[model samples]
Target chain A: MEIIKIVSLGIVATVIIVLLKEIRPEFPMFISLLTGFAIFTMILGELSYVIETLSTLARRVNIEFAYFSTILKIIGMAYIVEFGAQISRDAGQESIAMKIELGGKVLIMVLAIPILLALMELILKILS
Target chain B: MGVVSFINSWLRDIVVLFILISIAELIMPKGNLKKYIRLVIGLLIIFTIINPFAKLFRFDFSLDKVVFNYAKPETFNSWELEEIYHNQERQIEKIYLKKIVEDLQSLIENETEYELVDGDISILKDEDNYGQIDYLVLYIREKTRNNSQGRISIEKIEPIEINRNLEKDFTEYNNDESIKALISDKYGIEKNRINIKIYKKGIGEINE
Candidate 1:
């Protein structure tokens, strides 16, 4: 209904998740997964619309489609890794979560190279 | 959305997850079901605290859209008369709609504002005509940049041939006799308790 409602639900879900973790640790992880999915389902319609509009705006600015998609990809990865990392910590494996995060950072850096190369080429031409 | 996600990039990780879950279930320290349930809940919160970990197993690649959606709606459910809230999910457009309508309604209903404030949402009819199967309309007025304003106006636009300029298909959330059912179904707020106020410029609000 409102943004606050979602927050409350999140809090409740978090509380439930915390209680779940101490006993059946596996169930806690499952609940975490389900909660992640539930939140996504809740806001899917809105995010889709925003992404669609942003894509349109990028097109209007004549930005390369590949460039735009790559940006979305990196963003998508960060979100997933972060979500999973937190769940790991909730499961009391903070070390595992940190490792997962490090891996995500590396991948993002690797994926960003093409964009950097494109920008460098543009700069060289401008200098010429 | 797919028949199979076989051989996808996350396949290895997903299989691992399935295996781990099964193992966790079998060897979960022989605790009470309640404790396990609590653990599940804890896992969820911990999961939220560190979101990026889930990314590794993600093949589709959009965790923000999923995780935030789950988290946001839970917060929104806490408001007074929340039952009256429609489309309770995290619609980004609703944020814009609510803000715009809040101003428009205040201006039109109060009438202190001299300038016209208008906001409208409509669901058109027919697949061939437009995708709007239903409609929502919102309007308001303003006298100046200052906060002083009039009562707001809002309507649900329909495929009516006659009322283009007229604010069509609108009912006050409170006091509208006709909207009793819709209000009951969409927002759980009672139809009678809500003190709905309405006003219009050239024409009055659609009561009948």
Candidate 2:
């Protein structure tokens, strides 16, 4: 399955990074960075499948597109931010990684509030 | 597309989400505020999982206005972006037109002492190659100096006098063999409409 292939690729990348870290210290960062980017892009390809299925399901369930897209954006933001911060940390930029995480948290917070409010409003309506 | 399989797949995701939410609620400290927050969050998750469509039941809530207000800013930003590009395009066109006017000013200076008022040059092209100048519309001010009291000095130019250049120079302009042939051979515009008239230098015109 795709999971196995991805896991194998991750293992291979880690092994290569470790081997290169002892030999050419500079090369390891670049290797790891590129591997992370490649993996992120590969995961993005898989995300398209998930998105397609979700959109089809949303359509089948007759859900409003706005909500579905908001959910998708939130999900995408989480994954992309997590991936970016991990890559930054792997490159030994702890400060930069922290800032990325901070920005991602702010963005996720901003994006999520509206949905939360809408849901609260819905619950209130039901209670009333 | 089958309803049964579709429900099965979505059900798995819902179960996972429910478990995660449940764990989150369990970890929270037991209190009135916690209870309300958990209930609200849990209900939201459950509603989203069961049928996100259920939120549409509330008549006051518009998905577009309430839940997806983020989408509006993108469109607004895009319009601002487009306006920036349009402003750039207008700036470029103004610069190009200024250059063309400078070229025309020099071209007219070679033959006559007429300063151009306003003009436009249109070009028509074919698929194969660069085409010819289709038509040139030029409004010019005729520079006329008079010898008053045996002294060659600038005369007060009248706007009324220069309009007669159509009768005087218009025939001479059209009768010019080289330009007439060039216009007929290249531009393919009708003969009579090509009325190239020169107006006398009026007030506020540059005098040479």
Candidate 3:
């Protein structure tokens, strides 16, 4: 998350779009799309690293594979949401952008629903 | 390899999650799905290229693995093994053994209540010369089980073995009562499920 990298990416994006806009208006959208993808990938790079580390850590600790894997998936969902939101913002559709963001967040929580339920079930069984 | 496969699995699972969500959204003449498809594409790029770079900067980018070797009674029975894995959900993976150990990997894979994905179990069968095993090898090719948080009832029935590394410990610690204890202890196996076989190294029968 270095400031320099982020700024450079933004500059590259702007330049790409600017160049693209001259050739064709629709080209700006495609250039922006590619630019947005590049930026999103840059951000996602962090998450993928995180996931890889988590898996390695899991192996190192000799813990259950499923447990950490679930955590990763939850984290992955959050990242996808954030990535979508940023790209959508770049696309300049605030309303649709929010929807993209909102969908990612809610879906992640939903993916986690089963785990949450299992935890509750365990607590109830323990108390009872 | 096990670690990479694990992350890839979760990423793949999320990708599938994206697809399902997109389908459920089912918006007429869906444009948003196309948009999400791009995000999915971005996710692949992130995992392949971006993620490893971050680890380069961190000093203590070390993650610890939980060891099944720590579980007591020399040889691990199923219940204790599962308990260990379930207890340390955030820390280690029991199935790392599953990746290498043939007995356990095949047990869970050959049949289980959970869904199977992205894991392969390769077992090299050993037919003993004097009705005794030469060498048995089980290689885990893939694993995507998420026992702690997922409802994937991965009934991983890893076959039991005396780890060669622990051979000395087994001889030193194995007294008559201990041997009996190994027999009597709960195996996390269902009732009437075990077939008893006694072998003293080669082909000689145990006379006791």
Candidate 4:
């Protein structure tokens, strides 16, 4: 039922975007961006449920919570960056989209540094 | 058996890690970033696999130690504690001595016609006279006017000559007495403890 609603919303938005493309080309970008946001919000509720279940599973297994949380953060960052980049691309700002992607990559690298350092230290310890 | 339980736990950890990574990849947005995330996940998997073997080999392999060294305080045995204390104390003393020498060098330069080239101080470490300057040795030379002129090229190399008349030159630069008195008066160090030596190579000699 939720998928049907999302599909119907997409179809209606597509029609409006197509109608506005000739008269006011800029309006089409806004319409598409609005539709994207609507679909994102709709799926976000389901995504939270999945994340909660994954975290509980991680807890049940007694896995290190740090790695689990870090992975979650990276996934969240990726999704947010993807959303921003796509929006920029839709607005025909290719450079802005690329910059957004670069920023996201740098942030992800910052988050991953600790894990990388730990791995390096481990390797060194083994070697020595 | 303990071995069965150990293997069971290890297998469970690896499987859980694999499943978690798979879920991450599944949820991850597809783009150029996917490969990087995959690389990090691969590293995590490698770390998890190698971690047990590292432990088996009795290596001190803990991610917490690497990541949280600042956040966490580690307990040390008495010997290590003493070593750390002595190291820190020595560092403080070294900085203190350096500052004192710099101050004395500037003082000598400002108050006298001599330029201090190098100096060292020995602090009393005994219980009664702790931290008192026990010995101070300063290598000094006469300041020349050419100090303002940047770099001067040496036109010719002078041949070395053995001069046996050293005491005359040494006693002639007894302007060091006034310098010793000034330091002793200002720093409260004993005049006998302060030793000033005239350097043979003055700034004038190098500039010429």
Error of 4 at B9 (Å): 1.4
lDDT tens readout by residue for model 3, B82-193:
8877788523333433443344334535543211121222222344422222233222222344464557676565444423332322211112232223323422332232
Q: B1-208, model 2: which lDDT tens digit per residue?
A: 5666667766765765555445444433342224334444554465556443343353555545666554335533578668978999778655655565565555554555655544455545566643344566555555544564578886664332212234333222332344334444544655543445445324334433
Given candidate 3, what's the lDDT at residue B96?
39
TM-scores, all models, native as reference: 0.35, 0.44, 0.33, 0.57
User: How many residue pairs collide in each prediction?
Assistant: 92, 0, 23, 0
* Candidates ranked by TM-score: 4, 2, 1, 3
Residue-by-residue lDDT tens digits, candidate 4, B9-72: 8899899888887888889889878876876787778887888778777887667556544222
Give the total clashing residue pairs for model 2. 0
Where model 3 places Cα greater than 4 Å from the true spot, the runs are A1-9, A16-28, A39-49, A62-64, B1-208
TM-score of chain B of each: 0.22, 0.36, 0.18, 0.52
Q: What local lDDT does model 1 show for residue B105?
A: 48
CA lDDT, every model vs. true structure? 0.47, 0.57, 0.44, 0.78
lDDT of 1 by residue, B126-173 (tens): 558543213443332223222225545455332322224544433333
User: Where does candidate 4 stray beyond 4 Å?
Assistant: B68-208
lDDT of 4 by residue, A1-128 (tens): 89998999999999998899999998988888889899989998999999998899888874666667777878888888988998899889999999999999988887677778888888888877
Grade the docking of candidate 4. incorrect
Q: What is candidate 1's lDDT per residue for A1-128, written digit by digit as tens?
A: 75676687788888987897787767867776777788868877876776676566545432234444445555556667777787788778989998987887666555554344434333344344
> How far off is residue A46 in model 1, in Å?
1.5
